[model samples]
Target: MQESDGPAPTSFPRPPNLLDGSRTSLRQILWALVFALTLPAVLIATAGFRSGYRAERETSDRRLQETARALSLSLDREIEKNEMVLRVLALSPAIAQGDFAAFHRQAREVGLASQSRIALIDMDGRVLLNTRTTYGAPLPDNWRESVLRKMQETHKAQLSDLHADPITGQALITIDLPVVIDAKVAYILSAAIGPEIFQRIIADQRVDRDWNAAVLDRSGRIVARSRSPAEFIGQLANPNIRDASAMSPEGNVQSVTLDGISVRAYFSKSPAYGWTFVVSVPVTELAASFQRSLFWLFILVGCILLGVLLAAILSRLIAKPVDRLVAAAQALGTGREVTGTTTRVLEFDTIQKALADAASDIRAQERHREEALARIAESEARLRLALHACHLGSWEYTPSTGAFEASSQCRAHFGQGPDGPFCYDDLIAGIHPEDRARQAEAVAQALDIRSGLEVEFRVVQPDHGERWIRISGRVRSGTDGDLSLVGVSQDITEQRLADERQGLLLHELNHRVKNTLATVQSVATMTRRAAEQGDEGAWDAFMGRVQGLAKTHDLLTATQWQGASLEDVLRSELDPYQDAMRQRIRLRGPRVNLQPGAVLALGLAIHELATNATKYGSLTLPEGRVSVMWAVALSLSPPVLIVEWVESGGPPVTPPRRQGFGTRLIQRGLAQQLGGEIKLDFQPEGIRCVITFPVKAVLAEPAPAEDSAERYAS
Candidate 1:
């Protein structure tokens, strides 16, 4: 279905209704009532029958389990009593002393005096004496080792399952008790009894007529069967009993297939012997009672359904006015009102009249909404005009729903789809990565505080490539009780580029100003020192220093205040003096790129240091050496620019209290402009000035290899 902006248009004709007014169709109403009433009744009856059957099956299983438990407990008591009796007899002094002859006579009088079969066996399980003449033969293999091991290790009574005697072939269980003398096993007293003695106890149980009970041995083999013949004995039932026997010796039920029919098996285990007793009953038989219960349940359900049908018919007659009111309200929701659709049913007809009134009220509200939409359209038009003038576009975002909408210029700014406005995510993706994190953080903080955010960031445009834009946004509470972000964005590309160009020009101007200051300082130093000289010997030296200063300033002017090469400055300044001599100088340092401020400061400082050396230090003699080397010390507290103007093989040097303008300029002027500490040491050896400054303040450029060689050659 197409989502209509408002109510649907009523262009199509309405379909004709067969039943109208009070003359409703009897056939249709009757059919609808019958289906509504009987469909649920039938389903409920079926569900009730299933629930009853399951409940009965579970109850029957519980009953059978109870019967198995009772049988297992009774059997345990009987076996325990017999085993206890034998154990007590085995501990007799006559038996523990291995006085088998005395034990045999006493065993016959005490144990075998009745129908019980008793015997006295040695530690090796050799039947040395027997009360019954039937057990006169040697012990069998099955009983001999078991009896000996029980006496030696456990020193407790062991009750064996019903087994056929080797000699008499009589079914009996043997109870063997160990005789311990001074904590050492000496003999075993054995007693055999008919299994019918234990069966009599199980047969006396008052179990249900359908339930059959049986006692199982330690290995899950049936030892005794009640309500059945011996044919069913010595057989295993469900394996769940055997599996649970080692862990849990208690009553439980298991599902099994018995006699080709599914049956629930209930079982219990003997705590004394680790044997499981199981009882199984057919589920079909158990469900008989539930089947009879469902019969009455269906009858009760039918009567209730008949009453509900009559009630539905009466309720429909009574609720005619309510139905009309509901229909009237539905019409209003669809932007239509039904007039005079009222009834005479007391309370219901009053509601119908209210619905008619409500429909009228809705039409008034709709007119107001239409008028508001008109005003919104006008405002939006004016906003668009203003946005166009400023090259700006507006947008709104609802964070709770992640919904967003933007204007035409916003999409054009980021080069998004022309037909559709740019999504908020698309706009975010256009932000430059360097500035995206800060812009995103500002947006998030504004959303949290319900305030406004204004930020500028670079946007990757489609046709124009990268352009900077300023976004202004405010978070407001919307009508839906959720925060909505509404914002406007304007392109600031040209303004940002203008700012960058202005910054570059200012930087260049600052470099030119500093270089000009250095030239003035050099010219002043040359004139002052020339006037102070007392001899013509110093006049050439003063002219050379002025030339070095002029050479460095020429390099600065050529670069237009941007930067200059350190090697070019050094070679130009030294060439005038070096051309007359066939001598050389060595210069070494990193090819450093410098800013304009550092360029002028170092140029003048190097000129002064070299001039002083040529006058009175190493450069005064032809055999003297002038090595100019500069390096960047990265491991300093702050990185520093270090230049060494070492003069060797000349007259001895001494410290001077009064410094010339040249010395003062290299110490204070360089230190002040470069923002670093400077030290000038005038030792007897040479003049060493170490300058420590931040890397930013140094004006350095890569020194050409040819320029460095020329400094030495000339």
Candidate 2:
């Protein structure tokens, strides 16, 4: 221990006297610190209370405003959706052709889907057709007359105020769009929207239960209410909201609701119409929140007062014992044997006793440290046992002594006996000449950098012949300043063989990935070519082909990409139709295993055939039927497989003027992709397709395949 320039403590006092300097100093510091910390805390609490109350007010105002705006947006979107539908209906050819019957049917479908009623009116405000009734139905008098007058004045689109239907007394609103031809108003399209749609929107919003929300039309009538909707709907909104809406499009005001509840209400009026949506929260709730903030502040102030009282009482109790414990501790640090003394405190008295015997105990621990360390030698024996069990080896090399030591297992790795004199030279001799120099370089570099060594090399073992060996080791310094390398070694012959096979598999995988990407790119190009011709079904057709490819890939994956049977491929494309038609669609084929390439080509062909049948072939008629048949011609040398697709009982079939993408894929792409021939015939009765490919192209286990077949056959 080094001596300090400061004064040293002689001994621990029995107990610090009340008049002792340390006890007095500690007591004074505790009192001063308590007041110093408590004063600022009290000030901060007071400031925080004021700020928190203001924050709560602002947050409440923001929530009310945001909720009002959000509710208005929801109402606007519902109206906008129907308005868009109206615009689309205006473009209906039947409306331009003065075909009210056809337009009414189309409008009825739109109204059912859009949750509204469609009404068509002429320039004279006379009803033509209303989907709520039917084509040429009797019209009620003065139906939306004022609304139609306003819609004509604007000559654009209009949203009507909330009103009760005269016939049903249900609250309704209307989205009116004028159909203009040559800058002339030919007719007005009105979509009568019920209040239930708005009610659903308000119900779906995630608002607090304490908040009340309502949607109001231009007339200040309630179209939908978040609470008590059935009872309050179709009634006039609160007077405060109406007054505020008149003053400005949006604002906040304190008012009592229709139910006589005092609330802070925020209203937002729709920009398109004068309709307004209001969100309100009870004023009493704000008062309750303010009380909660005050309640917590009072609890914090009480805790501060209690802390001051505890400090005054505890300071005197612990100060003297703490002083004595510190003195005893300083004596132990000075390397002096302390004498036990009482402090009248349990922890302090125990500490004093422990300090008194600390010097003697330290000497005893130093003496036993070596004895504890000697037990580590047993670990080496255990490690040797472990290495033998794991078929691994351990070795140590000391360059200074030119000595090499290894476990019995390590000797066996190099084909040496356990008791054999296998020294440094013999170990070097066992390494294959080709890898010896590389392993030596690794060892040299590790030693120069003082880092770990990891080297793998081929070992020429006497018993096992050639074996791959991987050794991992690190440089270690001995207690006597000598250096040695200690590490473990294992045979990796099987791993080396597996790596070779994996390299070949990876090469093949890369080739397949490129081919698959090319196929996708080709499909996209063909689809774009079809789209350039204004084919509306281009996207659907493209997605269907891609999905067919994916499903075919799934089938290949199920069999580990070896092959899928011809029947399985056919069923994949036809099962959906077969499930619905017990006998109309039939399949007859042998278990001809088709490789991945064949499956892909055949899957696209079948999908195109099925799509055509559904659109124009036999499948379009209730009485029509389809037949798929295939057979393997084993009689032919290097045999071939043929598949036929026949359909009958459909409308008279005729050939198209020019081939489309689907037809081209069937006739040209299929033949090229499958290395085969295909034929398509459009007969008077139905369509017929014949597909033929070499049997080897579809063989599950072909005799060492040709260069092309091996690509997709895996």
Candidate 3:
């Protein structure tokens, strides 16, 4: 019997077209236009509503800013006027000269006119005159001494914040005016203004609605408030209020929730008192008009959208079944077998027959299943190869049996032998002793918390070598509470070694450069001291000594500071005068390295001898020449390098009468650093100097360049 290659079917019948396809085209077009118009209308309406709301908010913010600025300016003017009044009182002839009767009479007249309390206070805190009493009351003892100290020290008018006066039992702000008599402060005239006046000014500035204005002292205590004066007048500052006051001096507006209602607030600082003033309006009230406008807009748009959606649903009921049948036929053409059964409409019945025929035609040509399987296998094989090349490995854990199986690459990463048992303990044993405990702890933490794992540590290779390995894993948990850890690890030994070498080289280079800078600073200091103590001749001699030290460094750098080669050193110092000799410079030596200190001293000695030869010795005339050579001692207990400088070309040579700084520096400097001796030759042909130094450092192996690849890969 032949197997059937047909799809089993459900009880859906093929649908028929209720309306002709040609007749319904115009209806579909009309409905499509309807949906398209409604979508844009909704988006445009939303955009328009937001724009209108933003404009309203901007206008409100501008009005609030303008009002706040005007109020602040007016307050500044009033405070300044009061300051001027106190200044007039301070300079009164009677007050400065201590004519008590005239000062008292003037104070009373001015107090009544200004409706303020005034008093005269001397440096000793004595009240000499009072405006409000039959007999003058003594100055209050509770007033801050800093205010008085300021007045006497600055000799200027000062303003104080509102405070409760113990003497008068009323809240008052005082202005202290300094009385300067012949450059000495005689007294301060104090004017105590009532707190009520400040309150009235704040009240006039208040906008209707739930708005408030309050002034806070430098210590953040409320001195006056526009709303509910007695409730918060002397209270400690609110947390949000205090922080805002400290940050800003210019007035600002913000929103905060107070009493569960979000409030929009404006704040400013008083230049006169270092005081912060805050005004707040309820955000709910400010945005009420905006919310109402948005509410009507949304209602209108929502009604229109609802009507369109209803009409679309009716059209979908008739068109949906036909769409399904057409889709089934298209699916068959694309090599997807369709059951070809639908009952959405009558026209779809015809579609069912067409789809079945196409399905058969397509089946004859399709090799989709076989091709798909082959492609999948090829992709997986390529993936495996790539993972092996890069040394990457994957793992899976079965929580059901608490069994963990890692890939072959993972086993290799841990340095496990090829046919050995692969388990967690074997992996742990491969970790370097120093890093073993850390890696173990990380793994344990991951397992305990049922979380992911990541770790890097050195692995002790089987050959007694070490390699760095990085391991990462994730936990798999079963529904029954069992958990298994799975992860991967790869070798990173080469990278780790490169990083370590790079770090070491950087440290060594920094240390050497710092030492050179310190040496230069010391030379500058000694030269300056010498010049300070000596005459022109002494200063010039000191400068010449410093220049000779600098010359050594220049020669060392020319050799890349790798170490000086003896023959290269001689030619560097002697080549300057080669034009005079025309053909008289000769050098012979095998390459040898010198320490930086040894190279510097030897270069200086060569420079000094060359200078002498050029000026007054053999090289003074045209026929002078120098021969330099060195030979290494291979048989000595410790190796030694010997260099000889022989000059023979122009004039006769002689030793100097007095040993100069250059002579002493070269002979003494080389002997001190190299533990060697220098012999100066005053030959008839030219001047020659010989230097002998141990090769203790030169015989040691030179340090190789460190690998830096780890840095780039990281």
| Best candidate according to lDDT | 2
Highest-scoring model, TM-score: 2
lDDT of 2 by residue, 1-714 (tens): 997789776886453332323222567777999999999998999889879989988987887787787677656656755765676567566888988998888787653334568888897778888887867879964466776677666567887788777888777787789886644568899888888888787778855787788888888999888878888988888887888888988879999888888998899987655678888889998788889888989998999999999999998897878877867765664544446555544445545655656657677878777666666767877876788777888899988888889977788778889997999689889999999899899989888888999999998988648988899999999998888899998988899999998998799778878877888898889889999999999999999999888888888879867778777887788777763536778765445677787787788889999999989999898888898866554433456666779898788998899887898877655677667777677877788776777877666654332212111100
Model 3: per-residue lDDT, tens digit, 314-405? 66775766677767765554533345454444455446555776857566767787688899999999988887888887666554564667
Pairs of colliding residues, candidate 1: 593-700, 594-699, 594-700, 595-699, 598-699
Two-way lDDT contest, 1 vs 2, winner: 2
- Residue 272 displacement (Å), model 3: 96
Please write out the lDDT profile of model 1 over residues 1-714, one tens digit for every residue. Answer: 997699867785543221233543334555567678777877887887778778876776677767778677766656655554454355345664656666656566443224567776767656777777533455553356855875577555777876778888776678887765544666677788775765666666654556556677777766766656477565665576567665676655556532344555677786557667767666677667876887878787777778767866776675666567656654544433335543433444344444665657678879989999999999988977888888888888887898888877888777787686456788788888798998889889998877888998888766648988888988889777999888898888889889998999899778766857666666566556656764354456556555655666677778765667656666666555563543546655546656655666676677777777777777787777776665554433354555656666678888776767576666655777778677666656566565666766774543333223112211
Pick out the ten consecutive residues of candidate 3 with the lowest summed lDDT: 705-714
Alpha-carbon local distance difference test for all models: 0.66, 0.78, 0.66
TM-score of candidate 1 against the unseen true structure: 0.34
Q: Score every model by TM-score.
A: 0.34, 0.48, 0.37
Pairs with steric clashes in candidate 3:
15-345, 15-346, 16-345, 16-346, 16-347, 17-346, 17-347, 623-649, 624-649, 624-650
Q: Which stretches of candidate 2 lie over 4 Å from their true place?
A: 1-24, 111-115, 145-154, 206-209, 326-714
